[model samples]
Target: MYAFKKSLSMGFDQAVEHVVEELKKEGFGVLTDIDVAATMKAKLNVEGRPYRILGACNPPLAHRGLGLDPDLGILMPCNVVVREEEDGSIAVVFMNVATVTGLSSAEGMKELGEDAAAKLQKVHDAL
Candidate 1:
């Protein structure tokens, strides 16, 4: 799969909070948050799941990647998602960093992706 996912037993909000703390412990910070359900409702008038996309970044790794290729910003922050399932449980997911970052031609990006993927794996495991 292109992502690492875990079924969480906690409520949606609590799962989001737990994910943030776990990511912090792994030296990552959430740089952005996209509320998908809200966006879909406002833009398309469609009902959707309780979904949030979190842009998580490890600054040192990002800096290294950017230094190799300025255009790497497209792949800078990794993505973590918290979405409510039909069963009312939350699913915490992380994009497979190496897979997504593979689109970059940055010199050191492969290693950076590996390192970033490792951290994200830890975050997923913590859930």
Candidate 2:
């Protein structure tokens, strides 16, 4: 509904690496990589499975979106999450740009969102 999800039969680190590579191929870059598991353990003294939140961005598309609506910056970079499941499988999830962008009232936001979603779909299909 709000995201595209896939389960990977690979190591946690490997899955993250693969997802990053695929994003790059789709003209997306990893702007930030947050290791949620480690952060939680250090900041809250809680243990958890391996989990990472990747902030991905496509510079050209971001520029266009900004030109259309400055406030769209709130959703600038997309998110791709890679987390280890209790079943020992890795899960890779991608933000559904179309769903999020639909919230905007900008004139061309829908088309822009569809374009971005297609690119992400390519990455999803690749993996």
Cα-based TM-score, every candidate: 0.93, 0.98
Error of 2 at 104 (Å): 0.7
- For 34-105, candidate 1 gives per-residue lDDT tens digits of 999999999999999899999998888888878877888876588899999999999988899888778887
Whole-model alpha-carbon lDDT for candidate 2: 0.94
Best by TM-score: 2
The positional error of residue 117 in candidate 1, measured at the CA in angstroms, is 0.3
In candidate 1, stretches whose alpha carbon ends up further than 4 angstroms from where it belongs are none
Candidate 1's C-alpha lDDT? Answer: 0.88
In candidate 1, how many Å is residue 86 off? 1.1
- Candidate 2 lDDT score at position 93: 95
Error of 1 at 77 (Å): 1.4
Model 2 Cα lDDT, one tens digit per residue, 20-127: 999999999999999999999999999999999999999998988888889998986899999999999999999999998998999999999999999999999999
Candidate 2 regions exceeding 4 Å error are: none
